[model samples]
Target: MRQPRKSTVEIRTSFRGREAIVSGAAAALFRREKEGGFFGISVKLHARVRLKVIVVNSVEYRPDVDCYIRVPDPSNATAVAQGFAPRRCHVDDFS
Candidate 1:
């Protein structure tokens, strides 16, 4: 039998000057709209060492590593604010 296909999105994020890939359903949350609208999702990292993260939309994010963050969607703030919560991400979480 064929294996079920996983629905995932790819997001290019950087940390500490190094580029990394974040892939999965969560990544889809960071996808930018087609009309060149507001920046994609907002991520805030909390780590001992300061790091810089570059998202797919060319927006720069500098949050602590291993910090829980709520993905911000400007288009639908109320929905995202109500539905999502701050989530933690580890270094290994990025590919």
Candidate 2:
């Protein structure tokens, strides 16, 4: 899949009735929306991309998507190992 252009850019956003569905990383705080049509959120972010990450032991091979996920801690260690954000290792790293 073709990855969307990844670039952080500042944007002023106005959410319509309910069409504020956006994807990608945001590095800003979104203020609360007003009653009528108002500026819902303004932030600095990257271009939206289709991201689907597989937290396997494999690092060299990632699915055709973007995911820099970090699972919340204090859950279960087993869940962490087999869950999100697995270590990215080389061939020699494994037996």
Clashes of each: 6, 1
- What's the residue-level lDDT of 71 in candidate 1? 41
Give the candidate number with the greatest TM-score: 1
**What is the Cα-based lDDT of residue 12 in candidate 1?**
75
Task: List the pairs of residues colliding in candidate 1.
Answer: 45-63, 45-64, 46-64, 46-65, 47-64, 47-65
Candidate 2 Cα errors over 4 Å, as ranges: 1-44, 47-72, 86-95
Q: How much lDDT does candidate 1 score?
A: 0.44
> How would you encode candidate 2's per-residue C-alpha lDDT over 1-95 as one tens digit per residue?
34435656553544335554354333122222221212222222233333345543333432232323334233445544555444342222121
TM-score of each: 0.21, 0.16
Model 1 lDDT-worst window of ten: 32-41
Name model 1 segments beyond 4 Å from true: 1-31, 34-81, 91-95
> What are the per-residue Cα lDDT tens digits for candidate 1 across 1-95?
12234555455765343553478764554353312333344455442322334433333344444444444344665654566464556553231
